[model samples]
Target: MSTNSWDPWNYRSGSDFGTGHDLAGLSVQATDGHIGKVDEATYETGGSYLVVDTGPWIFGKKVLLPAAVVRSVDVEKKDIYVDLTKDQIKSSPKFEEGGTWSDTTHRDEVGTYYGQYDKGL
Candidate 1:
């Protein structure tokens, strides 16, 4: 995805998938099937994301999903939908626990990985 994909609306206060509700613990669904649940989420204007806990799906690993990938949010159902498939999420860049996402290098690594799918790179 382009950097503009990270511009915030995907998870901003007044955007399509964004709302004034806590997203923690909400189930996350991929295009193909269920992936996990939101372990953490950020609402920063330019840097938003969902940190999903794959709970046994990936040996209890967590993956960071950029807000841009979020396709929709179902507040009533407590679910977040993304445009990617399980395999795609599974093979994306690994998220090291306790690592800060504010680090540009790490963000770039992740952005690049996801970008490839968007750009068909």
Candidate 2:
């Protein structure tokens, strides 16, 4: 499903940006949310992302996501959904949080990880 059809598109809106918010319950699965995390941040251009906190293994890391990887959102419970799997998410190369994604090299990995899944959405 497109972000527009999601129940709570507030995050999809621009009213709130660069502010801390809660997305803990959103069903974030890759490959249609079978394995992603919560809907973390929606970019300024209407693109949403999943913050894959690397947990204790790789420390707390995060990543960016576009609608291409997103499948839907649960508005009734204020949740976000996706169409991915855990192995796929876990297998992807990890990154450090916050200050990481700024390099061209770092940005390139996004596509590398996403691979054909990007589909240029």
Candidate 3:
């Protein structure tokens, strides 16, 4: 007998209603209004993140958002709510293509940027 257990329902642990794999293509909504659609997502032991493509709104700029900032996922509405504003996300650390997501330096930079918002600084 095989000892490996399979959980189709729990394919993604800690996921709210949908997994990171299912997050792509979903619209990302900031506190004020819709920001963009998810271009991609990264799921790791440390954390998850989404790359949102701000189509036309900001000249097609993209941004990275930590999963911690995700407030909720509405499958029916096909939307992901984040506890931030358009200006906040627009001003956040820009996500560079090919950048290492696991790098401590990068993580610290991003964490610090978002931390400032939490402190209202």
Give the residue spans of candidate 3 off by over 4 A.
1-15, 18-21, 97-104, 119-121
Which candidate wins on TM-score?
A: 1
lDDT string for model 1 (6-116, tens) is 342245333356447888999999989999999888888778888899999999988888777777788888888887899999998876667886667677787777766
Model 1 global lDDT (CA atoms, 0 to 1): 0.76
What are the candidates' C-alpha RMSDs? 3.5, 7.3, 9.7
Error of 1 at 95 (Å): 2.0
Candidate 3, 30-90: lDDT as tens digits: 9999999998776654566777899999889887776666767887788988768999988
Clashes of each: 1, 18, 0
**Candidate 2 Cα RMSD (Å):** 7.3
- lDDT, candidate 1, at 53: 91
- Give the TM-score (vs. native) of candidate 1: 0.82
- List the lowest-lDDT window of 10 residues for candidate 2: 7-16
Off by over 4 Å in 1: 1-15, 119-121
Question: Which portions of model 2 miss their true places by more than 4 Å?
Answer: 1-25, 31-39, 46-48, 54-63, 118-121
TM-scores, one per candidate: 0.82, 0.53, 0.74
| lDDT string, candidate 2, 46-110, tens digits | 33445554344334445555434544555555555554565566666556545544444654565
